[model samples]
Target: MNKEDLLKKYFRQSLSEEEEKEFTLLLESDHDFKALYEEYSNLNLAFKSHEAEELKAFLTSIDEQEGVKKIIWYKSSTFYYLVAAVLIIALCLPFLLKPSASSLYNEFYEVYPNVEQPVVRGSEETNTYNAFKAYEASNYSLATKAFEELLQTNSNPNYKFYFAMSLLNDGKFDQALNTLKDLEDLKFSYTDETLWYMSLILIKQEQPLKATSKLELLDKLGSSFKSKERKVLLQKLQDN
Candidate 1:
C-alpha cells in the first residue's frame, strides 16, 4: 500500500498482525527505515498517551477543591484514576464527541462493577433515589422528576449528582447541563463517573475546547477505569 493508505489504516487501527510484523521488520532494516518508523511510532505514542478530555476534567475538578493546595495521598491517587477514566472514554470511541454520558456509563455497569441498589427513603429522597435507579435502568422521565425533586430537597451532593445525570437521560438537555455546571462550581469528591458524565455534557453543550482540555491530563495519568479505555481515549485525543 502507499504511504497515505498506510497512514489511513493506522488511523483506522485496522492493521493486521502480518502487516504489523512486516512493518516491524522494516523498522529493523536501516536508519532511513527506522526514522520512518520512528515518526509513526512517536505519533502513535502521542495518540495513545495524550488525552485532552481528562485534562479538562482535572482542571474542572481541581479548581473546585479550594480548601487545600494538596489533598491527602488517597485523594491524590483517586485524582490519578480520574484522569485515567477520561482517556479511557475518549479512546474507546474516537470521533464520538457527541455521545451521551449515559452510554459510556452503561458500559461501566457491564464491567466489573457490582450493582448497588439504592435504599428506599422518605418521600423526596425516595423519589430521588428511585429516579437515579431508573436512570441507571435507562428510564428517563421518572428519573427526571425524581432528580428534580431531590435537587429541591438538597439532601446530599451524591444524590444531586444523579439528579443532574437523570436530566440528561431524560432528554432534558438544558437542565442537565445546568445542573452539572453548578456541580462544577461546588467542591465535591470528584468521581470518574462524575467527570465522565460531565465531559459528555460538555460535548453535548458544544464545548469541544473544554473536552480537549481534559484529554491532556487524562493522557498523563494512565491505567484508569481500565487500561483499554485509557488507551482508546488517549488515542482519540492524539489523533484529533
Candidate 2:
C-alpha cells in the first residue's frame, strides 16, 4: 500500500503490525503526509459530529455491506447518492467496523448464567440504547428526551449512566447528580462507571473530597476504569 493508504489505516485503527511500523517510520521522516493525515482526522471528526439523517442512512448502508464482496451500483435517479454512499463507506470501513454493543456489554459486564440475564429486549433497554447512540454522537437534545422517557420507566444501571451523561452534557447538573445517585443505588455491576460519573458530579457540585472518594471506590473495582483516569482524579482532588 502507498503511504496514503497506510496513513488511513493508522487513523482507522486498522493498521497491520508491519503497516503500523512503517507508518511510524514514515511519520518520523515525512511532514507532508502528517499534514495530510491531520486534515483527514479533522474531516473525519467533523463527519462524526454531524447529526443528519443522511449520514445515519449512509452508515446503515455500510453496516449492511459487512459480509458482501462486490457492491452493486444502481444507474437510476439516485446514482449520485449511491456513489457517494459507496465512497463514504469505503473510506470509513476500517474505523466503522468496531465490535458491536452486545460484544462490549459482554466484555464489560461478564454476567454469568447463574446471574440474571440482561434485559436486552426490554422496551426500557432498547429505548435507552437508542438515546445512548444519540448521546454518543453528542446530540444532547434528542438524547435528553429519549433518556428522560427511559428514566420514567427503567431503573437499569447502564441506562441510567448514559442518561446521566446526556443530562450532564446539557448542563442539567442537579438532574445528572440525582440520576447518578439513583444509578449508584441500583448498580449490580459496572460500579466503576457509577463511581466515575459520581466523581464528575461531585466535582461539579464543588465537593472535591467527595469526588476523590468516588475515585477511591472506582479503584476498588479495578482497572477496567483507566489507571490514568484514577491517577488524574487523585491528583485533581489533591490539588483542590
Candidate 3:
C-alpha cells in the first residue's frame, strides 16, 4: 500500500505486522513521508482538542438553558453550520500556531538510536558491550566514560558519533558540537547524520544562522537523511 494508506491504517491501529514494518521503514528513511505523518498527527491532536472543547461548550449551553429546550435548538440547520465552522477551525488550528525555533528543535530532534552495537541479552561483558548497554539504557554518564575509553584504543567514526550523542544527552552541548564538527570534517559514513545533529545542536544553542548553513549544505548534498525536515527547518529559521 502507499504511504497514505499505511498512515490511515496506522491511525486506525489496523496494520498487520508486515505492514507495520513497512511503515516503520518509510518513517525512518522517507523524509517526505515522515513530514506528512507529523502533519496528520498534529491535525489529529487539534481535532481531538476541538471535539473536547465543543462538547464542554455544548454541556455548558445545556446547563444554562431551560431543561431540554436548547437540546432542540442544536437540531436546527444553524447548529450544523456551527459544527462545520468548528471543524474548519479545528483543521486550521495546527497551522495557526507558529512555533519558535527551540520548540521546533524539540519537536524534531530525537536521540540517535544505538544502531552500531546493539546490546543483546546474555552478551559477553566487554567494554564495548557495556558502552552500548549504557547508551541504550539512557545512562549517558557511563556511556560517555565507556565510549571515551574505547576511543583511546579505537578510532571508529561510529564510536565517535555515539560518544558525541552520549555527551549531548549528558548536557555537554559544546563538546557534542566539537565532536560533530570533527566528524563533519572527516566526511565519514555518518556525514549526513553529523550535519543533521550539528544543525539540531546549533538550533538548541540559538544559532539559527549556523544551523541554517548546515541545513543548506545538507540540502545541497541531496542526502536523504531528514531531507524534507531539513528544508522545513531551514524555512522556519529563515522566516524567524
Candidate 4:
C-alpha cells in the first residue's frame, strides 16, 4: 500500500502485521515519510486531547453550576470513540470552510473580564477603581493611561496585564505584545492568560504563523485557560 493508505490504517489502528513492518521500514528509511507520519500523528493526538479536555471541562462546569454529581461518561470506550469521531469532523469543518484569520480572530477574541476590581456605580474615584472602570466601559484609551499610571508605582502584574490588554484593545499591538512578552517571562497568575492574549494580538496583526507558534507553546504548557478555544484556533491556524 502507498504511504497515504498506510497512514490511514495507522491512525485507525488497523495495520496488519506485514503492513506494520512496511510502515516501520518506511519510517526508518524515508525522512519525508517519517515527517508525514509524525505530522498526522501529532494532529490526531491534538484533536483527541482537545476533545477529552473539553468533555472534562463541560462536566465540571455542569457540576459546579447545577450542584449535580459529575457524569463519568468518558470512562466508556464507546462514548470515547463517538466523541472523537464527532469532534474530528466538527473541528475539521472550519478548515474545509477556509475562514480567514481576521474572521477567526473576531470569532475567538473577547476582552478579558475585570475579575480584579468591581466597577460599582458612584464609588470613590481611586486610581485602581478608575482603571478597571474604564476597561469595563470599553474606553481602552483611558484605561491604558490609568493602568500605566498605576504600574509606575505598583508594578503589579495584574495592573500590567490589564495595561497590556488595554493597549491591545486600543490597537497598540506592538506595545501590547511587548508587555505580554515581559509578563510571559515573569512568575505570575496570568502566564496562560498572557500567552492567550499574545497569540490573539499576533493574529490581529496578520501574523498567523507567529500566533500558531504561541498557541503551540501554550498547548505544550498544558494551560486550561481557554483550552477548548485555543485548540480550535490552533488547528485552524495550522490548516491555513
Per-model TM values vs. the true structure: 0.43, 0.43, 0.58, 0.57
Evaluation by TM-score, superior candidate among 2 and 3: 3
Candidate 4 least-lDDT 10 residues: 65-74
Ranking by lDDT: 3, 4, 2, 1
lDDT of all predictions: 0.59, 0.67, 0.90, 0.89
Tell me the tens digit of each residue's lDDT in model 4 across 190-212: 88899889898888788998898
For residues 147-209, could you state the per-residue lDDT of candidate 1 as single tens digits?
Answer: 677668765666666776666666676786667666664556544445555555555555645
What does candidate 3 score in Cα RMSD to the true structure?
Answer: 34.4
Q: What's model 4's lDDT at 174?
A: 95
Candidate 2, 1-240: lDDT as tens digits? 897788778877999888888888777778987788788889887877775667888888887785342333344547778888999999978546744323322333311121222334544656756776567567877888987888789767666666766777777878878887876755466566666766766765667678778778777766466677578557745753
State, as a TM-score between 0 and 1, how close model 4 is to the true structure: 0.57
Question: Judged by lDDT relative to the true structure, which candidate is superior, 1 or 3?
Answer: 3
Better of 2 and 3 by lDDT: 3
Identify the runs in model 4 with alpha carbons over 4 angstroms from their true place: 1-97, 121-123
> In terms of TM-score, how similar is model 1 to the real structure?
0.43
Q: Report the lDDT tens digits of candidate 3 across residue range 25-118.
A: 9999999999999999999989999999999999988787765667677888888999999999898777566666669779889899988997
Query: Model 2: clashing residue pairs?
Result: none
